[model samples]
Target: MACRRLGGVPWLFLILAWLPALCAAQTRAPYIPASPDVVLQQVPPTTDPRVRRFEQLRLDLQRHPHDAKRAVTLAQAYVDYARSTGDARFLGRAMAVIDPWMRRPLPPIPVALVHATVQQSRHFFKASRQELTTILAREPNNAQAWLTLATVAMVQGDMDEANRACVKLANTGGDFMGMICTASLRMLTGRAPQAYALLGLVEDPGPKAPPEIRAWIEGLMADTAMRLDRAALAEQHFKQALQWTPGDNFLLADYADFLLDEQRPRDVLALLQGDSASDTSFLRQVYAETALGLPQAKADAAAMAARFAAMDARGSHVFQREQAGFALHVQHDAPRALALAQQNWTVQRAPQDVRIYLEAALAADQPAAAQPALDFVQRTHLSDPSIDRLVARLRSDAMAQAAPRAKP
Candidate 1:
């Protein structure tokens, strides 16, 4: 029995592609392949049947570069591949496949949609929204466009816009997809307990359901559980999701975060040690390594610095959140971290973004700087123990700073 959470539209392909872009340089040493089938790169080896099919698609597209249908198909495959493995590098491949269409003033609906998906994957929210808007203006009933638009809005902290898009999605797609979409927004807006109950009643999708969709539902449940402070339940949900798609980068990073929060740094290391190609996983490994006082943390931090430098050269601001964390924890630069966090807040207002902003403000002794985040918390009624504790600390610090000091 398929659970009526988010029906149809094959959202599995687009969901994780919405994760923050965190590609990093590969640091593994080069090795010669001893066997013809040996794979030197990629999360799953090319020997996997799926990868073989993808390669064949790529070859076909290469032979017919001007084939719009073939280009869209392959680009969609690349997006799915990136979501499955948490590898943003595949996004570039997707872009290359769609580049021919994008150069034109107005590409076809399918090309524009895929292009917008890739843009979102790279954190180009404004560009993505513009593309989605163009598509919707032409075809208002485009369920995928509405869903993608809603996501871009949510990421940017525009709850009103997101809700509007969700309503449209429900009307166009189905109640289930709308419910799942709205439930996610509610999870972030202080109604997590309710969202958890609503989703729990949803029966798991049957064997016919796509694995990515199964993973997405389980991951959403896990995240909602975490917001409600149900750590044990959250862990179970995370594990279940991983069973469906173990190599999902966003899932691994999120689980690593849970482990870190529980003070199980060793477990985080065990989970993310071999996944440094993704900056998200790489940063988590640094956090775990630092917690355990491992010698390798220093070298990893240096590598992260180099990666950030490269990102800066490219003028990319997508990883500002991760960069802020590294600056604070790994580089021990509180002021720099605070600046990055503040700048990042201007782009993303997710709970994690707000928490980092609060943390950076506190570390920099700039309680005044945290007012925006504090206001956001109060306004949204966001539920998270960690965020609440940070709020309390900031309030306490502000009071201490304001109290009259006795004359010495």
Candidate 2:
């Protein structure tokens, strides 16, 4: 589920490392523990054991704030929660938990990993890469460090570095993780068919693999299929992923985009209903509402505007792509959307990024401004039906504009 807009790899292995025992234990009725306000989603005591463990960990860390080991453990748990919930605030909480070791010349491996995770979540790729490099220099056989480095490199569009890190992972880590790492990069680099076929070779680990990992692989397959114009296969893979990890924000957002592209706004609404806690989900809901011309669209657009304004006021520019889409589709400000999309392109060149840039450029009647996107398509040899249609339309419009006026 590590789509371009979502940022970074899925980090399923990190979550797998901390999964609690699944056995049902005999105990009294569950009660809420007095924990910090950092918990974003409230899990009733009687339900998910993961939530119970998270609550206990929070309370334990609060009691022994000076204990480095407990702090690292809690921070790691918070990072896992952030990944599962898509709540960026949990990343901030993870940073707070590890604040004590932030300035150390060489923090513990656990703390360093948490720090890098938080940095990457916040879009600080360079900082995260630096930390991971330092960790790997010290522990050359660190599988997690290699995987993280590959993820950071992929996000930054440095495929060469990502390939190198994947090779390192394959040498140190098992083939399963390494294959996933390499296949994801291949999918982005115009080898969708090969990536999909290679990924199909991954043997099902059954209980050995976490559900999240399986869901992530299925999601990637769905994306590859979509790029290949295999709509039926893509939808099937998406369905399989949702079955594995129901209500995952990343999966929900990605499927909503697919529905939007298919002109199924109602399905998008149904999928994202009552799921607006994360910014990604909220953006998708806004898009769906706008497409349906729902009464809530106005309010949702205004709310998103205000949220972006607040982020701008705080000097946070990590959401330029989402903001640009809102501007183009919701606010109807083509120029502003083009500007934001251009700014976003300078940071990430994923296919979605190119699409938005092309969209804004076309909407604003600035075909020349879309050269970067067209160049990207040519350079990467990316093939997507939607992008192909857009390119054709852009050419048609340019020709229509350039036609001579014979009779004045």
Candidate 3:
């Protein structure tokens, strides 16, 4: 999930899979630069209140560059903007805004939170968790700290720690956050139906809930419903989420994926029109074009490849999952896809991650290579019809290969 800025305050919600870790220890490395030449779409001047407020904050930060409070505020706003727009440049911009305190051993809590948010965005999971831990040790009742810790733990597949952090968050009057956090973990642990119902309880079609929170909950419900193979329910939740927060890149990408899976490539094309700034969105467009055998598929594929190459040149492997999927499905490089998927599995074990690993392994004709994902599925009790079918096919293929050739 992406962070959101509301009423000049920034709040984070664990939306989807976990972020990656740049390293176990923090370093003052140069920021990974995104491609400057890639232009997705141009936006005209906006009169939106939120945009106006963010601009004011930017002006304030620019005027008071040395002011820690202003810097953190602007950085948080940037982080929120990055989450909303799926623009990598915003994340780098956030890091730049907080560079003054990057190496500080004891920055203020707000500054530290901003630093951790930047690190988390860059996939430095261990460093982000450490920053959260340090903050919690000093201010034990910090709701944001607890929420961030829970998010980091969930991403790392440390459910026990995540659940404990959720408990702490709930104790700090974050009942709604706690419910969503724990429910998300439950869904991953094969309690999809229960998770869906629990989220419904939190979002009972009431006007009392914040639109942002409702949108996030509906998105999660949509995901869980999809896992349960309730296509209609999933579509309903997806549409409802969009109604609440229109033009959300994450929602659009998720819906595009659902459309792609349903073989409605044209629907995906229409859904993601003019939304290519984000790597994920562009990747989905590539998938749709490839599926429909459109000429633009080649150009889109080349553009994505160049983007990934830029990430590589900067030594940023934070997008292993997306890269692996691209390699496997579009590039048709099964071995490379398997390698990337394996690397990705070490960081996140979400169902999407597992599916990629399994798909890559199968395509590579390396059933043994898929054991880790299969084991994860068994251990977590994760159930997806597509994943199960793939597992069964792999098993049957293995059996056939091992069977004796009597008439040879």
Candidate 4:
């Protein structure tokens, strides 16, 4: 299960990678086998086989420091562990272990594929593309490699490559979850209709699809629907997905997004009650933002503040969530909130965080704080209508307010 989570954590497929020289670097270092320390989480219950394999690899590597075979095997196990658990640090460790051997003389093709999965997590599109190219050159019929290439190509905004890869993989057999992947990608790229059509072919209504495949398809479908301005569809699909996979932290987060968008901030708070404190920054933001409309919002801020503080103190979570909080609370002597939010943003560049900080600065009357975010949004060219409309309204209203207080 850890391996499966690692295999599928959002955006993780973009980061880590393997190469031949990286392995060489490890080989020369104090005779130390690349046993990169793998941090793990026990939650969500990883499958026992994945856990057993991860432990076996760790022990094997402990014994044979120089055996590339064992090290590569161990790294793949770690990838599996990380995927199953949805924790990234294990994959990071896996990369450190495999780095010395990437590219200068690529690891075995399968091992290289594992390496590519890590790279994909980091959004290193170019490297990911290279990984697929190399793998396909060696074995064009490798379905997983092709699907991955398609996925990464979509990440890099290379829709044509993605389409080609998907077209090729569509014919390949096995529980290929290509529809989910392709449809979601298409939806994000502003082809919601195509996404929906592709989604129609997914095995969601069937009794035979495995839970993992079902969850993947359902989550993507819900998200695509939400982004395409189909909030009701999003809500329905999200609830259905949840029914199929209860206690999914990711699904809860999506629900929060939907609630906030629909102006039901209190619902967001209630829905996220069971989520881990660190995981609810965005939802917490919905609370903070919606608080202005509530008579007793300040009362809730304390708990939210505590949650942020605990997360800040915990130090394992990323910077984006923290940045969002700062953008929310900095207006009223909330320096700690601002700092924490900024801290998280600095550690990682999340577009959502950028949006929050932009809005926060605007609300706080800190134009300087907003400039960079403004630039980032413009550069990224995200045409989020709600945000654009809000910004436009703010400007228009500001201009109107400034025009005449003359008679009064």
Candidate 5:
């Protein structure tokens, strides 16, 4: 997904999906089944042409491992699978597939791009940015390279850099891809309504539109709708996107979060059933179970705690935001949660990052610690009712406490 943001059309040359945070659970020690029939993993058989093509590519790459073209193609496929499934194990595989070319001082352009993509997928933003910079310096009009660079900048909270990259993308003659990227930027920077309206044009690009494009647009629309507090519309868009890509872990996790906010934990349970292999999905499931007061919530929380411990042991900071959430919501350790959230906020400034930081600040009764999130909301004018409520309460509490202290 890092390599592909929104599907490119013609001149744009395939732009695809947003890169999601990788699940750190993939770093756990390998589990060996006592018997082959024990079924450690299960995927329903599929006759899907893409899956068949991927299988063929896998075989071809196996036979010709040194073929850079086949290797890049297969690695891209693996990255796509990692994004859709929320299973980062595929990302490691992708990196390994391209390792041969990575050793080169100047790998082939295609290999360089895919390598950058895998690095971005793994949250190595600086490395990915450097790789993309090198590629763009060599080929300025490369649409894919430009779009990927924009994604990296956006995720890193460098909106100006992202806009510059998007401008470069538009100059490369891919109006549609550039438009989508720009709309995404606007949605994140206080123009959700306008971005939502702009996306309507691509909402129904007829049957000719690729599933990936349609699904990506719908997901974006759904998020914008959520920001605007149009809950029903958001749910509809989320459902439509899921119909397009049923196994998309990003969609499932997002929709599940929406359901939880709507106080429909039962719906989350139904939505995320059998999809907790990834940390994101599993965390959502834990939230749902907590909401329902299910008996299994305790065990699940402990299991999740173990996973976070493993991640910390590996010195992996990519999942700090998620770990903060687990600490606050599941462990109810407000102080620790606030600490983690503050640390994560130093890395990225996404809306969710702000939300968790504010929530943890509130829970820990540390109103002053919430100043960064407060400043972000004021600067961005981000419109989210839930976040607004938290901000309002935090401000009120801070005022009340300050008043008492002043009187004393």
Candidate 6:
């Protein structure tokens, strides 16, 4: 699904109907910039069609030794895969691939790009800044680098920086990067029209775009549609994305959540593989565990536990996912879940995570938990039948509790 050249990597984005591009609201702490500029050189191979392909590049690296350029290419591929896939491990793998020669320099354009991406992925704002600036210092027109810089800025909640960087990159290509970034700022900043306009660039999925690229677009389209309150369209795009990337864990999780919202848990069990090892698979683990009467409940729970526990929540997607899991499993605290949902409800997961958590909290008789979520829904001006239903339930429950009763 991705084309990662020998030096530069590709990001893998799933079909978009899942949630906010920001993924999750991180709680740990601020992302620290790399203390020092980590310069990497050693260009990867510029030839070989197989080397140019992601699968081939990965295999080529595994088949050989310190091929710096190929390593970078392979690493970048992983980064791109991680980005589009919404999987942090792929990013970790990208970092791991470059860990050995990170002390050295001179890989290739693509390889260096991958490193810059890694910094961005880690939310190592400082490092991302340094690497990006340095890269642009050399290749000023490297639109991808500019996009990476902008994404890092966006994650930091630096709207100005994100705008500036995204604007610069916006014209770099008529491709997905420019359109997606421009639309991203628009959506997050409450410019649905602007965002939708940008999305319109990719009116239909391209046949030539690789699988990963296709998946990313699908996910993006779904996200935009959901924001516009197009549930059927969102589900449609999600299904398409899932079809394209069957092995994609992120897509699976998103789909599972969608299923949950649709009250179709019976389907979740078939898609998600439940096992102790599935722990690192965050969203999928959640899907497998939540679907009651799952064929292999115990195994699914174990997998969910292992995967969830092993996850590194630095990435926004992973962090938010883990938070949701905590609300679902550890806390069973609908209030906490509702809090987490509303925290990001404005961003994405519109009627799903936000509403589901709020509803669950109310259904669980946690009126306090439902309060903040209600305020959030009204403030955002989000009007959905589901939200209305849940709101009514919460209000009714609160009223019942408040009513005076005859002495029993």
Measured against the true structure, the TM-scores of the candidates, in listed sequence, are 0.87, 0.83, 0.85, 0.59, 0.87, 0.62
The residue pairs in collision within model 1 are: none
In model 6, state the lDDT of residue 261.
Answer: 65
- Model 6: per-residue lDDT, tens digit, 72-120? 7777776765654455556767766776565456545566677777765
For candidate 5, write residues 282-388 as lDDT tens digits: 88889888888999999998888898887776556768888898899889999999999998877777778888999999999999899988988887676677888
Model 4 C-alpha lDDT per residue in residues 1-408, reported as the tens digit of each score: 001112333224232232344566787754444565753443423465666677777788879876778877888766655554345567777876665555345467776787787766544456667877999999888898988888766544455677788777876633345666667557645567788778867745488776656766777777667656788887888877777765555566667666766878767666665343333434454463455456445544555556556544533343345435534543354444445445544433343555455555555555454555455545544334455654564456556655867775
> Candidate 2, after superposition: displacement of residue 135 in Å?
2.0
By TM-score, is 1 or 4 better?
1
For candidate 5, the TM-score is: 0.87
lDDT of 1 by residue, 103-124 (tens): 6777889988988887787777
Q: Name the runs in model 5 displaced over 4 angstroms.
A: 1-53, 404-408
Candidate 3: regions farther than 4 A off:
1-50, 62-67, 101-103, 204-209, 399-408
Q: Candidate 6 overall Cα lDDT vs. reference?
A: 0.61
Better of 5 and 6 by lDDT: 5
Count clashes in each candidate, considering only residues at least 3 apart in sequence or on different chains: 0, 0, 2, 52, 7, 41
Quote the lDDT for 205 in model 2. 51
lDDT of 3 by residue, 1-408 (tens): 221111111212211111233441254565555887775556523776666777898898878877888888878877776776777566656766776665466677887887677667767787688878988898999888888888778777777888899899989846777788778888888888888877877876467777777888899999899889988889999999989988777788888888888899998888888466778889999999999999889998999999999777656677888899999999999999999999988877767888899999899998888888888788778877788888897788777778999895
Best by lDDT: 1
For model 4, where is the 10-residue window of minimal lDDT?
A: 1-10
Higher-scoring candidate on lDDT, 3 or 5: 5
lDDT, residue 165, candidate 6: 79
